[model samples]
Target: MAKAIMVQGTMSNAGKSLIVAGLCRIFKQDGYRVAPFKAQNMALNSFITKEGLEMGRAQVVQAEAAGIEPSVLMNPVLLKPTNDTRSQVIINGEVSGNMSAKEYYLKKRDIVPEIQKAYQKLDSLYDIIVIEGAGSPAEINLKENDIVNMHMAKLAKAPVLLAGDIDRGGVFASLAGTMMLFDDSERAMVKGILINKFRGDKTILQPGLDMLEELIHVPAIGVIPYLSVDIDDEDSLTERFEKKGAVGMIDIAVIRLPRISNFTDFNVLEYMPGVTLRYVKTVEELRQPDLIILPGTKNTMEDLLWIRQNGLEASILKHAALGTPIFGVCGGYQMLGTELSDPYGVEAGGTISGMGLLPAKTIFEKEKTRTRVKGRFHSQITGLLSELSGIELEGYEIHMGQTRPIDHQIACLAVLDEISGQQSEEYAGMCDHHIYGSYIHGIFDGEGAAQALVSALLKAKGLDCEEISSVNMRDYKEQQYDLLAKGIRENIDMDQVYQILEKGV
Candidate 1:
């Protein structure tokens, strides 16, 4: 079994994921075979592994930092919210079924064995496992059935580092209150405390930190500075949605669906210079931009209905009429078609009228399409997007249905296939004039595709389209990981962390 340490937060969005990712990178740099583990994750941001298995994106990012291939064992149970009350439960990377909150809570105990099995599998393969806990461990009402906090700590025999968000204010009370909720044995499992997202001088915070440590009887090992790193976040509490910046020359707006999933697909475009990518939720927030995007959603039919009910559909259609570039991915792709049929009650057992932006129709199927694909843009393109022709792209598909074009005039955007050399002439997406729709997520992660698209947008705006150097997404991510590791190493006490891991509770 591997030596392990777990990061539990006093509340959600307390920087547990980032801390664990930083630790993974630091351990990997020190020549240790480290991996990330989360017993259960309730999030909409997910990824499809090379093996076509589903896992949380946070674990995938942590795995990248560790310089290891992501495995389903790293995230055993994934809960993707379908609505306010129900979620689609995935165990061991496969769909178990959809369950309501009450039903899932009652049955959660039965999944413990499965979680333990996955944990042991990773433990046998790696030298260290940095575990991440979901939400807070101090939810006293839910702690009895908890498999992700103190209970998980006891199961893995892993020491815990409780982190509190200082930026949210009352960091001392948050940490102390969390400690008071836990029993003596449970409190003993927490080896140290960390203050995350600190912005001001540490010298001024020393008094509060000292009082917090004395009250909780746990040493405050670190005060991590608030970092501005571009990494995939776990859930709706992500800061990316609220962050607004000056609109660059090339402005891109993404429709923020209520059930948005795989929103990280646009992160690369956000990193590009001279581009301002913003997420718009309401029709009023929609602005005239060079390009507009519809991101993936957990429930396509429902979210599409939301667009219609909220008048966003009218706003999008109006933009499309003005020849604004419109693109969609996954569920968004389904919503852009002419019609959508949900036969299996996947999202409601009825047909819905799509935005009719593209000449296509979608049918919901039981099995999900999950695979990695490599390909090049179609030889032909429409309107201002002709520059995208011949650009190579690599991405993954994770969707619930198949979309097909209704007419031969609608051109396919790309010719894609499995990375294993299997050829697929299947029309992956449809493009008609300035309107495009595709089921492929992360298509813009590659430099060729992203750069070409940006150049076309620049040309459409009648701006000088200078040839910019292409940036490799993978290399950029590695640099960010290094930055995160450096931040953690300078602030956190690594010696104390190692000591806690060595001498477990």
Candidate 2:
């Protein structure tokens, strides 16, 4: 069995995922095989594995930091919320069914075996496993069925490092209050504490840290400074959506759907100099730009209705009329079609009119399309993005609908040469005039794809592409992981962390 350590947060979004990722990178750098584990993850952001199965993207990011290919064993249970009270449950990367909060709570015991199996598999393979806990463990109302926090720590025989976010305020109270709520056995499992996201000098915070250690009887591990590393978060609560539009040489606007999923598809564009990618939720925010994007959504039909009601749909149509170069991916691609029909209740079980930017139509299906594909842009793709012609792209697809051209004039945007390890030339996506849409997520992450698109947008704006530069996202992410690991190593006590791992509860 492998040695393990758990990172449990004082609250949701307390930086558990990032801490786990940074520790994974540090361990890998120290010449030990490491992996990340989350008993369950609830988020709209997901990734499809090589086996055409879906898992949470948080674990995928940690896997990248660890320099390992992502696998389902890292995350055994995934819950994509359909509404405030209901979620689509996925076990072992396959859809189990839809269940409400109460329904899932009653059946939580059945999921323990799956979690145990996944953890055992990872334990057998890696020298160390860095486990991340969701939300706080002190929710007395929910602790009866607790499966992610203290329960997970005990299951893996892991010592806990409870982290509190000082930036959110009440770090000391939250830390102490959490300890007060824990049972004697649960409190015994906690070996250390970490005060995260501190923006001030540690010398000023030492008094509070010392007081916290006295109250909880747990050693204060470290005070991690607030960092500005570029990495994708797992959920919509990410601060990326709050960014005010910046004045750039080329402005790109993405419609911020209420249930937007996989917005990371456009994150690489943020790194391209002279390019500004902004998420616009209202018509007033949708400024005139070089490119307009419709990003993926978990519920396309309902989100489209949101656009219609909020007047963003009219604004987008107005932009498309003037040839502002509209682009979309996955559910966003469906929104660009003439119409969307959901006959199987997969989404809304009704028909809805689309943005009509392209001559395509979509139908929601019960069967989801999940696959990793390799393809290239059509050699003769038209409009401002024609520079993307003949460029190779590799990405995965995860959607619950099928789109087809409504008219013969709609040109296929790309031809997929391989899907899920099988060789097949399949026509995918559509391109009509300056409007481009594809079913592939991370379409621009491939080498040269983002560069060409940005260069094209720059050229259309009468600017020199040589003035701005972009690096491959893979290399960029590696640099970010190193920065994160460096921050963790310099601030956190690695020697104490190692002892905690060895002296498991």
Candidate 3:
């Protein structure tokens, strides 16, 4: 069996995913065949692998760092929250069914075999596997059915390195509290500890570090500084919505919905030099920006209601009336329609009204559309749109609702089935209202698409700006990992960490 080490966090959003990714890159750079493993991931944020298998996007990023293609084995089980009470379950990259939290918790024991299989397969292929645990292992109520934290470490016989977020304060309590919560045998699996997201003056933390080592009986492995990287987070809690000094030459406001799904799509904009991307969570916070974005949502109706309740609907309408360019993607697209209908209750139970910005109606269907799409930018706005004509864009679609444009001209932006060469205004520019929506996510990855959209918005606002290219995510991630590795090498006990890796659990 290949040597393995588990990165378990003291709590959720303690930088476990990103650290695992950096470790994967570091191991790969050292000429070892490496892979990323997560026994379970619960998030609405997911991605389709090259093999068309659905999995958590965090593991996908880690796999990329490891120089390996993403597969179902990387994330054996995924749970996408559909509502407060219900979640859609994905076993081995396939949707199994919807289950309540209690139901799923009780039934998780049945899936241990599947988790074991994924681990065994990756162990056979890789020289080392970097495992990431979900949330914290110290949840007392969840300890009995914990397949992701200690149980996974035991299953793979992997020693653990517990990570604590010092930036959040209470680092000592988090570290010491976690250790105290674990049973004797389970606690033994933890060989060392790594402190993450430290801001300044490492010497200041020496006393705390000494105390943690003494209390936990584990050596301090690393003190990682907080590094600013534009990688996507797995859950909405850690999602970055605002940027400091991002009031660039051109400004864009992304309407942050309650159940926002693909906010990561705008991560590309943060690194784009000429643009400032802001996520507006409230109507009062909405400003007269150059462009307004309505991002995708997991529950369009519920979020639409939230928008209305929070006065965002009126704010968006007021902005649109001022000739503000509004763009919607996926569920956001569905909201642009006259009405949103979920008769089958595919997403949430019942029908709800929308902002009616576009002359279209959305119907939630039974079957989920999960496929990568290819399309060309329409040049219908000849004077300005001509510059964008023939621009190619590629993205994946994982939406359940379909929108039908009331007007034919508004449907010119998209060709749902590009192979058939059929054009539909519904997929593209729906109206002269400067409001557009699409089912595609990650559309800004393309240089042409990002430039064209920004140019149009800038032109509409009569602001002069140069066209900047979209971000190169893989290169960006590699750079972040390299920096993290450098920080770890300078601050961490590399000899002790390597010893833990070399020794079996």
Best by lDDT: 2
Say what the RMSD of model 1 is: 1.2
The runs of at least 3 residues in candidate 1 whose Cα sits more than 4 Å from the true structure, single-residue gaps closed, are 419-423
Error of 2 at 99 (Å): 1.5
Give the candidate order by descending TM-score.
2, 1, 3
- The estimated TM-scores of all candidates read 0.98, 0.99, 0.93
Model 1 scores a C-alpha lDDT of 0.89
- Expressed as tens digits, the lDDT of each residue in 1-505 for candidate 2 is 7899999999999999999999999999999999999999999999999999999999999999999999999999999987677888999999888899999999998899999999999999999999999989899999989899999999999999999999999999999999999999999999999999999778989998888888889999888999889888898989988987556988999888988999999998988888888988998888797898999988888898999999998988898899899999998999999999999888878898888888888998888889999999888898889998988889999999999888977787888999999998997788888999999998898898899999998888888898656568888999999999999999999999999998888
Show how many residue pairs clash in every candidate, following the order shown.
0, 0, 8
- Candidate 1 lDDT tens digits, 324-422: 989999999999999999999877768988999888889998987778788877889777788888777788888788998889787888878555246
Clashing pairs in 2: none
TM-score of 1: 0.98
What are the runs in model 3 whose C-alpha is more than 4 Å off? 242-246, 381-387, 416-433, 467-470
Q: What tens digits encode model 3's per-residue C-alpha lDDT throughout 1-505?
A: 6899999999998989988988887888889999999999988788876555689989988987788888889999999888889888889988887899999998999999999999999999999999999898999998999999999999999999999998889988999999999999988999988999999998998998898788789888888888766567777876475545547777889988878887888777667667788888887677778778899887888888888888888989998887777789888888988888888888766777778888888898877767666676664534333345557766677877778877655535554434223343335435444777777777676565667666766666687756556566667777876776666667667678778999877
Candidate 2 overall lDDT versus native: 0.91
Question: Which run of 10 residues does model 3 get worst, by summed lDDT?
Answer: 417-426
